[model samples]
Target: MADVETLHAIADAAASLQVLIQDAIEWKRQHLTDDLLSALIAAEDEGDALTADEMGEQVALLYLAGHETTVNLVGNAVLALLRHPDQLELLRRDPGLDAVAMEEFLRFDSPVQMSRRITLDELTLGDKTIEPGAFVVLGLASSNRDPRHFGPSADRLDLGRVDAGDHLSFGGGHHYCLGAALAKLEGQTAVGRLARRFERIELAGEPVYNGRINLRGLASLPLAVG
Candidate 1:
């Protein structure tokens, strides 16, 4: 009974969030005429264009996926730096390392911990054979830390890691995140600027987790910056 009530509450909160996002999408549709939504609406592929609902869905997806991922990326990066003052100092000394550092951050603590994919055909992975139509959840976080792909120091955060960008934080191929470039730019700018401006940064209290399993992030990160 309690579990059912909790699930209902969660569903209610999600619905409310969707409403808020849709409202914002509508507002953007009306007021803004020069953004991604507008572009998507105006986009044509061999005379085929997206309908109103399709455009709305695209915008909502961007808001849902891009917004939280970027927020969590920045938050997680800052938290990592705070925990590793030496690395933070290195970044403060050389802001150019932001791009590499961002890659390492994504690899060390990916915002999207896992991704889902439906098997189109029977496939064998190790000893397990997944039948067609089976839902497969790939552990992106685990893959990022895989020693075979990332070498001996896979678990460590090395900002200057030459192969850091090889991580699957943004996925790959056609299904790669559409807003990957934007997210990287925002993360680099935000974390780099923060490092450059703040002489000191420290956690003020215990951080609060979002409690989401797939999307790992903090709900609140109390900090003192100077």
Candidate 2:
């Protein structure tokens, strides 16, 4: 069936990406004596060392955490702009708003829609008790739309919002994304340039979405620009 093939294709793609990341990490470990790789190597105790397979998995996770997050940021930003004309025009005037704009954009349409975590022990959130081994799925997008955080205009795209970064798009606390700065820079560069150059940029047709609920993004966006 096509469905089974598609599932296999997705798995194959993930596996391929993992291999690529593994290869790069291995190459660097072989050549470079940098602190990051060195630290990873140093973490190994005398009795326990990082096996080849373990190292590969670690490197793969690192690559996805860094690479996939940025890809989503840019893709989601473009989709947001295409849908909101007023915000796009406003951004064209003030290039400096790129940073805040990205924050707002991320809040409005978070690239990674959901995150999962297992409670270490019995925990109480509000009135409910989360038992150990319970899986919790936090909806980042829904939280961004929370009236308490952004007030009544949470759903509205306000580029000049004072505290747009208050959203949990990049998450919070110790688990916060490591490559946040790099991702922000890339988004700012791309969006800022596009704003300055294009006199008129509009979607040519209905944009195709990736159809993955966890990753709300575009597969292909047909746009007309002048």
Candidate 3:
């Protein structure tokens, strides 16, 4: 997931992350003879067939997706709260709103904006017929803001929004994000602590966006905090 093409960030940071991915495969290869994972699989008779590429992909998926999702979610959530003081106050006054606020944060400004899938069968969605085998892109962020499910305040930020949990930010079904739980927990912790800890948080300067469509996030949140 640290593919340079997908993650357009500081080159140095990107290089360092890429190195981590490469090291994971090398580390596995170096300790293959004594690796606990291999030993466990062998004990279960599953065979030692996981290839280096597969291992790298898994590492990449776990490292990048999990980390980036929470990073973006926390940053975006904080920025959103800063912009909406009413919601920020609610979060600060009530610790119970931490989990619920995370959902709205994910919905209001999704960290991962889009998800792709191949149609299994010809289907009509909003009068557009998509054939089987067709490449389809689902706009998770757009769906999250749809007035249909979220009512007229869909476009607005509502910490206690009833249907915020129905958001597609974490995707859906079997292909849903594996790091969804981790991301939520991290987001809740980060956002909750910030609201409770800081007396004031406001945008100090212009916010910097990563300018990415898929994994969109704030590159930097220039803030005035107290």
Q: What are the TM-scores, per candidate, against the unseen true structure? A: 0.86, 0.85, 0.83
Summing lDDT over every window of 10 consecutive residues in candidate 2, give the lowest-scoring window.
38-47
Clashes per candidate (backbone, < 3 Å): 0, 0, 0
Candidate 3 residue-wise lDDT, 1-226, digit = tens: 4688656666666667668877755565456676544453344345456555555555666777788778999999988988899999999999999998898999999999999999899999787889999988989999998888888999899998887899999899998887788789988998899899989888999989998878889999998889
Q: Residue 31 in model 2: shift from native, Å?
A: 4.1
Clashing residue pairs, backbone N/CA/C < 3 A, model 1: none
Q: Tell me the whole-model lDDT of each prediction, alpha carbons only.
A: 0.87, 0.81, 0.83
RMSD of 2: 2.9
Which candidate gets the maximum TM-score versus the true structure?
1
| Candidate 2: segments with Cα more than 4 A from true spot | 1-19, 30-49
Q: Model 2, range 97-181, lDDT digits (tens) per residue?
A: 8999988988988888888888889999899999999999999889999998789999898898888888888777788876777
- Local accuracy of candidate 1 as per-residue lDDT tens digits, 1-226: 3598899998897678667766776676567586776566447323556665565566668878989999999999999898888889999999889999999999999999999999899999899899999988999999999999999999888888899999999887779999999999999999999998988899999989898888899999999998
The candidate maximizing lDDT is 1
Clashes of 2: 0
Q: Which scores greater on TM-score, model 2 or model 3? A: 2
